[model samples]
Target: MRIGLIGAGRIGQVHARSLAADPRVGELAVTDLSPAHASAVAGQVGGRALPTVAELLDSAPDAVVVAAPTDTHAELIIQCCARDVPVFCEKPCVTDQDAAQRLVDQVAASGVPVQVGFQRRFDPGYRRGHQDARSGVLGELRRVHLVTADPAPPPAAYVTVSGGIHRDCQIHDFDVLRWVTGREVVEVFATGANRGADHIGAAGDVDEAAALLTLDDGSIVTMQASRYNGAGYDVRMELAGTEATIAVGLDSQVPLRSVEPAPLGHPERVWSSFLDRFAAAYRAEMAAFLTMVERSDPSPCTVDDARRALLIAEAVAASRRARRPVPVGEPSSSPVGLGSS
Candidate 1:
């Protein structure tokens, strides 16, 4: 399987390395607006760099992974599908629900596989939680609380172009909620504030945000996302039900202090290498995508999954914007195009 990569940013580079590492993949090709950036990554993976999207398509790679910036996803995806090149797009399929639906419809009609990069679903911890939820261990689920925070805010430029806090950051939690519960979010009520940093406010984002989401089955999920945290990245959830409650978090990491002096000091758990976790998931997701491309197998993250995740994110953003509860529904009958970046 030959893989071509679009964009040479941090995630693009990660995917490039992961794809190359897969024994199933033969050669890797990469492209970025900045040719130098593309070449640098290509050098690391023993892959050539393409100058344009068309060139990459003309190369006839078995599949293309679109890891470009969020704003450019829709068009590049459409183009890849047009070439009958399967795509593996990163999260937030599109910043807006309407555009995302259109893209989804197009892909569905094409009968080609396009997997969204919600790699968290493949994480072993999350997978265990999902199984427990599905196996009735959480018995008649009542509530799910998700807390996700980045170590620090993104660059001002990225925060500006990113759809917003909900779309840019919290959307992962929204997707995780749906995947774990196996239920659709029917409505959302969200609240946000710009208390963390003045720069975040200037970047058109809230430093802290929370949402109360209701699933169609009367399941309630509480999601909290923060762009600033004093420590390393933290993503955890506690699912409570009538029978029992299960919680998963980044419990242990490096930078530990040991004291065997009978309650003299406490050990500090710090994860110095969080990327290792993500790398495992990335490899799993890529392998799944390759299998789909080879045998036309069902994708791990289908278009419907992407659409639903985006819907929940949009609902949360709308709820925050209007300061009222918002119901999830189909994008307006009037289909729309891309939003201004």
Candidate 2:
């Protein structure tokens, strides 16, 4: 299938490489804010760099991959669906819940396939845990704990626009929590601290935050999100239930220390970036996306899936502000076979 990619930055390049490696991809077109950067990425991937997104869309690729930044996602998806081109978009969809809902509605009405990028669901560790929980191997899931901390905070400019920790980082956990538990979140309570950051308050956003959520199935989930850990990228999950417990992304390496070498030693060595940590998952994600394009299958992660997670993130922000439990709105209808854990 022919493919067009937007945004020739880091994540865009990642998608470019993944598409280049996929045997099903027949043609590749690229575009970016900086046309030169677009040319560079296209040259590397042996694609053509269109001067504008409209030009790429006019080229009539079978599908387009939207790897652009967060704020641009909703508009891009709307435009793609208008053109009858399927889309595989990076996460968060958009910062505003209402706007995101509109995009979901637009895509549905247009009957254009849209896959939200929740690649961690494709990661081996998370996939296995999700399967275990779904298959009743974990008996009845009671509690879940997810931790995701980057080595350091991004630039202040990045922080200012990132919609804080909930949307930027913990949203992945929010989606995973729902996907693995097979339940909807009913309430959220969140708190955060901004101490010891290289940039104080970091554009008024917390450097570290934690959230507690109650699920419809009566299970509970705790998410710890931080922008700085002094160590490399840290993302791991633990699930406990009636019969047994399970863990992912953390290792039991012999060397136990607070310096990131125990309970998951050398996670730093294994992953210097979130991109590194989820490389295989991204590849698998792209493959699944191609399958959707090939077979007219429902998207692996629908626009509703993206909006649901965004709603939880907004609820978390609201809870943190109110210093009380905030009720999340309606949970999505049960997803049967979307390959969700």
Provide C-alpha RMSD values for all models, in order. 3.9, 5.7
- Top candidate when judged by lDDT against the true structure: 2
For 1-341, candidate 2 gives per-residue lDDT tens digits of: 99999999999999999999999998999999899999999999999999999899989999999988778988898999998999999986877776777787888899999999999989999999999989998888899999998877788667666777787889899999888878999999889887756553735568889989999987888889877776567788999999989988865421124655444444224456788788899999999999999999998899899888988887887777667888896332321111111
C-alpha lDDT score of every prediction, in listed order? 0.79, 0.83
lDDT of 1 at 121: 88
Clashes of 1: 2
State the lDDT of candidate 1 residue by residue for 1-341, as single tens digits: 88999999988888888888888889899999999999999999999999988898899999999998877888888888888889999876776666776888999888878999998888878898999999999889999999877767777777777767777778778888888888889989988888766767775568899999898999888988877666556788789999989976634542223455633244264543336435678878878888889898878887778888777777776667677898887342212221211
TM-score of each: 0.90, 0.92
* Model 2 bad stretches (over 4 Å): 198-202, 252-270, 330-341
